[model samples]
Target chain A: MSPADRFARLPDLLAADSDLQRRGRWVTVDCRVDVGDQPFFLALENGALAAFERGTRLMRSSAFTVGATDEAWTQHWQPVPAPGWHDLFALTKRGVASMEGDFRPLLQNLQFFKDLLALPRRLPERI
Target chain B: MAPVLDPMIGRYLRLQIDGVDHRVYFEEAGRGIPLVCLHTAGADGRQYRHLLADPAVTSRFRVLAFDMPWHGKSTPPDGWEKSEYRLTTASYTAAIRAFCKAMELDKPVVMGCSIGGRIVLNLAIAHAAEFRALIALEAADFQQPWYDTAWLHRPDVHGGEACAALVSGLIAPQSPPVSRHETLWMYMQGGPGVFKGDLYFYRVDGDLREKVKSIDTKVCPLYLLTGEYDFSCTSEDTLRTAAQIPGVEVQIMKHVGHFPMSEHPAKFREYILPILEKIS
Candidate 1:
């Protein structure tokens, strides 16, 4: 499946998972994730994914953007990534990923994003 | 380049501390009074790579940096994989004591940053006469809350990455790009669960508020330095802690952060030289 399709599935997966829903509750933030060339925006409110959209033009309300190479994203979405590709911070630290704009929200809800991003790794191969 | 001095050497020593054998990895350079440097939590001796290379430091003092067990090149003892490795004050001090004894370092001037910084207080309090002095960077009574560790223990949450982000946030906003990236890279390479295990000591087991009053500066002079942007242990935190310990000297490192030695070695060295001069 294309990265966009996989990203689009995140909202539903987040909603269905009770743990993420509860943990993300009261966390409202607009974030952008750039996988390879494909850029996606996620609007999260009250612990639920409010919106998931594709493209680079960010919502004026977006707080931060997390971008990584396609290869890095591919490795990250694997069931078990190698040393450098396992975490978003790891990618940023290794220069494989970049995070821009306001970082407060990103750090304030680090685990939420950490769990949210790992969702795609659990999807079936056909998805 | 100027004339090349002696090159740094990397070696391992087998030592039994607290009844467990550990293969400790360490780097050494120069010859003179021993200056033992300790790296931050989850990081190894490589943080002092530049310090080891600096002739100003090496010419006067024999500098050595060792990787704590389960960190950097140091291997964990038997059965470590099955159980979580937590760094309590007792375990940390024991390793340092054993390391010093094995190296035959007579009252070495020990310096450490972050968890390395926090443990030096314990070293001074328990074994004051063992070291000539103590230099602590980003040392505090306790670290403030930054990231939640519950997710770090989860299977989906990669500890190394989570730790990198947590540490990156504490770095000074004005740190140079190359230095910042280099410092971050160190966190990325940490062993699994090492960061979290070390925090247990930094945050919980290493609380020195009640214990700091017992430190005798005359026996082992305590020097505290905190970076301007280190939110984990702010300058204010170090100052407040320093106020309690009589004769303890404190300084605020401008435009630096948690990892002073690694983040900006040249800048950090400038601050350190004055201190070393006073001691020498």
Candidate 2:
């Protein structure tokens, strides 16, 4: 019922999204999504989501890390989020979220990654 | 079979801009006051297809939309591969003026979106007397650096796909799927590096904050319309720009985004039709 929970379901959601698979067919990366104090790590292989888990040990590496407050993530997942919170770059520009690490993988697979993260919007509003 | 024909007519004109001959493609429909529509950056005039086909719009205003050189059906001038394409304020304004002169459009009402939107302000500042009025959509005098544009035309990335993906979020989710995809399709078809070249004017050379203050809206009425859903050119940005110029009209369109005319033409019409009527 939270953005973290939704993050956990991404593997399943992505496994079923054929269009996203095609879009990310060449993308392979290990990334981290930090929602406030919580961190969700994702492993994407080719077009499929290889693994998604919470918590990472010290010195663990990720291609990129997208960090924002849990509230930011929640608002971003709203069916129709407010203007500033509606997009990744928008959030970054507003200083609400931060993108760190190599940008090549993210930029090359921008639509897929953007859509992948936004998959949680389908959840009920009350959640 | 019932043969169907669209009112819109497409044509090419040989124009000499800055003493260089360039072939430009334009589409038009209707008659009366000339309403020149400028497409968004990285896109062609096809963005106004709906406006060109709409009888309501075509009946009163002669709507014309043209693709800038190196965009859509318009071909870049000779020896294009030898030089990097960078759309500067000076070159962009000259192209618009040259197109108008070549077409013999007399004091036409010019409407532009995004980069096209920003150029109208420049046009107003430099050549206000040459235009009847100017309508700017999703525009502002200055924009904070959002992202590096180099990724747009890099050999490592599919420039067209990257460009399309990056801007996809700028469209409001409420827009119809067909219209939204149609808008992105144009970005996907943009010439390699052309989108980034256009952004050079948008992000760098096109800051008009100090100069926008010089615009006398009385000489040529300026109407600015920004979509509520557009983060690229937020309504706040337009309001800030409007606040700089006295007597300039500003409207914040709801449920619309960057590509108003293309992404959601039907909804866009609700906002534009009234403005056109007001102009008439």
Candidate 3:
């Protein structure tokens, strides 16, 4: 399957996973996750991933943007990524990823977002 | 009876720290040289549960783990609500000294993790003669804060859950499911704003690069063990800090991360048992 097609499945996959739903119970925000240069905008409402947009919309704004290189994302989803690649913050701390925009919703629902971004790991292989 | 009682004993003592009365909670077991264990930031003495329970360690050393004021079962000093909780270098070392004096621990070996790891260097610097040895885990001389700590205690966030989640990534995936979750539970139970308060010391007040050379390893030996997966204070950080102190021993543990004792007690035991033997 194409990478975009795989990302398109994020909403349904996230909604179906009860554990992810519980973790995101308090989160409601639209955030953009960039895998390398590919942008995937995700809308999280209350506890569910409301929408998944594969491409950037004109004049579209997000609550936050969390991104890493294709290399970093690939490493992070390796069932067990190496020491510096295991976590989003880990990637950020190591200078391989970036998180910017309004800090409130992003930091408040950090775990939810972390789990959300790593959802691809549950897939059979790296997307 | 199927019910199993732990070999460790728990008790509380009222001690004066910085002229404030603090009811500190502590647990201990075994007998020999006094081995005082210090927990990580925002965590209590309970992190050392496995160490305190192990017969191999206890038989040769009196393992004592104490919860600092404002952590674990320990109570904050009177009028704590009016002021912010920021741990400074002086206050941290002073508390350890006072605890040691009150307990009459004669030159005890002090072993600590995370924030506990940072302070042991100061303990060695300011008062090396007061200890038999110092074991530092997941430690470095200095670590810049990687994220805004304010997120840890914001009104909009569930402080406990946020704190636990933020730290969850620091534990290695190689750790057992039970040990990993148990380690995070400590953070989940931390008091509001306490984790941020601890970072005040970890990130701001505890920069030890300039002062570490003052640590005299001759008077009290210094041992550092960092897990391979702890990006916060990566193994490189431990090695760099160890290089600063002549005769300081350093080892990088494989298949473990931060919160070694809590996240993988059995694995942590493999690394620490050898050190305990060397100290013996």
Candidate 4:
């Protein structure tokens, strides 16, 4: 899938997840996901997704950034990621993924971020 | 304010335990019966810092807290990489036995929290005659379904940050900001792979459901205390485990989580003093 196409599907996938909505109910944070060179930003308000945009430049403030190489992103989006690709932290720990900026929000709402990122994993492989 | 009673701080000692030289860091305070304290997973002897400094508790008993091998100020044994720094029950038990023996602590009251808490049960069951009593905080027979270490154990996963984030959730919501930060800081400083190694003992290799019944209360009376907000080892989980072991006493601390001694020492002390009175 094209980067834009993949980014466009995140909002719908996030919205449809009842567990994510419920667990993220109290969370409100701006998160950026950088897949290879393609960057996407998501704004979560009160545990619900508020906005999503595809761009390299972070126009607005962001709480944290989760970035990874194309190969790493591909493996992470797999139905069942291999050992090192299974978690964002795992990817970061393995030196394949990079996380920067404030960590409080990501740590505080860890489950939400974990579930949110895993959404693409649940998507059909073709998409 | 009451004058603080100074604890007898001991220097870090390099002791030969389980046949390898291990740098065991420990501290001691107070005067009477020995109370050997164990720390949580990924953490060190500092978890019991408040206990060692508390005047009320120390005056009545000599409190000792030591870093497990490869944790805090303690160094892992030679050729530790062979095991990838994993903590097995056999290794944990051997260390505890060696620590007690080296200190010449005669039948000390063994008190531990989390991983420390879980090991006291093993100590009581396997070597009951060595301890005068056992005080286990936030301990359970098993922690399946509630916690998972698969992601943390991934070779690429940075065990320190991942484990710190994972444990941060288990802290009580009402814990003081300073207490919470300090508790998280302790986990952050843990050696790489050490936390996952310890969890191997806590979550996997430390299954004691069948073995607990063999614990002779007469040899070492058991007291179980769990924090109200410790989701990993909930009060209900501890209570359930307590029920299976005859003569096991149980209490649940309010406004505390997994790291009771570090997260809320005053409240933890309130719960502990009463138990000590009965046991000591």
Candidate 5:
């Protein structure tokens, strides 16, 4: 499928996924420029592990990840995958900016982060 | 290891006190009435590096500094013992008494930073006759028995690497570098059980303000100080605390936070030294 088609279809896929649910508002993307053969971006809220790697491919490491509480999050010292994930997440969730990132990884691991976006929907089923 | 004494300081000592028998780590420089300085939580006595370096500070008095037990080179208490105060506070107060007797100090002026400050407050309340004067930096009153029960059961606020990372961010300049050992030491010195115990008992007890009013000390010049961003106490709260103690003096170090001694040394000395000279 074309990159545009994948981008356009993600919302529907999230809505349809049994194992996912949309949380907060729009999802965030991190595009790692350097690190290894593939660079991945992660999304987070309150410094909890969200999802990442829109431009690269890697197998699912875990089905779901948790985030730290607001206090713990404030104490988190590790740098995030991308530079602007926090601010961008805030802006995009508030409808201030469009979701934007490079296209290479989205074409590679399109399914996972999209599933991540669909995470909120699956919560009732999981519980 | 002999601490790498900063040339800024003159003579240093490693002595063992009689009552406690625990190592008392101290450094002395310049001369006048002696000022005994205690470090804040999660730090050694050496934190006074900048305070000792100031020309103005050295001119007025002899500064003697020591690390609390389980901090710096001092050893931890061998066994648990109940007292009027919590474990950490008790050892520190005992150490102060022992330090005084060993040195034959005649009510030497005393100053403490953060938890160290809290210890001095407790000392003044219990042994008011021993200190010529007292000053505390961001010291919270734990004697009134205030505590947060909810937090007592939770994991150490600094439980793991994430917590250590957070601390590194707070004291990055003081922290040498990132390593598991350093992180673990931070958590240990910021004692897992005792740290929470002190906080829980002190926060919920609710009578610390009143207790401060009754301390029968020499009206021994008492000064309460904190930085602009102190997490433990706000300027408003610390000032209110000072007001509760009849003769307590108060000062706020600007452009710094909880660890004012490390973050704003020159200002820390600027405020504390003169008080030592006056008392000495």
Candidate 6:
């Protein structure tokens, strides 16, 4: 899938997943290069950023290369001059906060709901 | 040219404690009394890198530095005991204590910047026998009654962005992208965890002011170092917080922000090394 398409569908996937429903319907895009720096992965998922990082339902930040590549996803990432380290850091922080705000309910009741889900439901006694 | 001193490189250890390998990067130089150095909330031990590099500074004492659990080389436990238990000052302090026991050193003089300082306070008080002296820089108490009225209500603070900048500053101005990423990830994990922990720490109604004052770690010649432009806490508030703890030696550095060690290492040593000497 193309980068834009994949990133766009991220929200839908999160919204559809029952497990991530608690993270609320929000998508965040994070990009990172692999260990070898050969391939980049862009994580587009519908849910709060914090949930991806700290909670379950693993999320990967989107990654791309600096030069030409045959991979379909790789073509989607065009050359964009990188910001200063400080500016990029600021952007990430803002984006994370924005994700958190978008998924406020999840951020708010995250602990309570997660704990509740972990507990076995107490079904009403059979009449 | 950043100060032309040798980069202090020593055994970066990983001690298995509480089911996780707690990585401690420590360099012991000029032994007299041991100084256990802890970095601020978002940064790792290397924040004190220059200060440790200075012969004038390292000449005074042996330094035990560790990237706190979930920070630097240390990663969070493979399996958490509980879901919401990953970010807690108490748990981090336990890891530090475990590291100390593993290394088999007396409490020595414990100095921490920002959250590091707060952890030291937590450790010293909870494990009173562990600490000989205490130094805390720009400790935050967002849950405090007064700060809630001021800090929370202030719209201009930009807490999140400010925090991000601080993170960038710590790692930036660098080489070897692999090392940089590793460092960044360590901080990313540590920052969110510590920030979350602080939110929990300050949720109480009564001020921690009294609890901070009550810590019995023998005053050990308390020292407070902060930047003039510290966004974490106002200069007035920093002084006030220092005053709450009886008989603390306070020094305010000019033309600096929240991360004094990063911005002004020489000034930091000027204020810090003397105390290390006295303790030694």
Best by TM-score: 2
Model 5, B1-280: lDDT tens digits are 8877554543333445445446556677766666788775455666676666666666766678776655566655556344222444454576777777777777787878766777667766777777778878876564322112233223433222222222222221222333323433443455434444434323542225566766654556677887654434556667777777776777876644556665555455566666665665
Tell how far residue B191 is off in model 3, in angstroms. Answer: 1.2
The candidate that wins on DockQ is 3
The digit string of per-residue lDDT tens for model 3 on B1-280 reads 6879999999998888888788999999999999999999898998999999999999999999999889999988989999889998889898988898889998899999999999998898888998999999988999756788878887888888888888888999899999998888999899999989998999988999979988888899999999998988998889989888998999999989999999999999999999999998
In terms of lDDT, the best-performing candidate is 2
DockQ of each: 0.05, 0.74, 0.75, 0.05, 0.04, 0.03
Please rank every candidate by TM-score, starting with the best.
2, 3, 1, 4, 5, 6
lDDT (0 to 1) per candidate? 0.82, 0.91, 0.88, 0.80, 0.50, 0.49
**TM-score for all models, in order of appearance:** 0.71, 0.98, 0.96, 0.70, 0.56, 0.54
How much RMSD separates candidate 2 from the native structure?
1.2
Q: Between prediction 4 and prediction 6, which has the larger lDDT? A: 4
lDDT of 6 at A95: 34
lDDT of 2 by residue, B45-68 (tens): 999999999988889889999999
Q: TM-score of the candidate numbered 6? A: 0.54
Instruction: Please write out the lDDT profile of model 5 over residues A1-127, one tens digit for every residue.
Output: 3222223333444546444343323324343321112233444432233444445456533223222222222212112211111221222222333333443333223333433432332232212
Better of 1 and 6 by TM-score: 1
lDDT per residue (tens digit) for residues B1-280 in model 6: 7787565666767687666665565655556566778776545777676667767767666677777655555554566335443336656676677777787777677777766666655654566666667776755333222112122112343333333323433332222344444444444444334443443433432135556666553645566666554544445656776676666666776544455665555555667677667666
Give the local distance difference test score of model 3: 0.88
lDDT of 6 by residue, A15-65 (tens): 445655554344344433221113334343444333222212244433221
lDDT of 4 by residue, B1-280 (tens): 9978566586787678778888888988888889999999899888888899888888789999999989998888777777686788998999998998888888899999998989998988899988889999999887654435665655555566667777765676566878877987898798877887888888778999878878788778999999876767777778888888888989988777889889888788899999988877
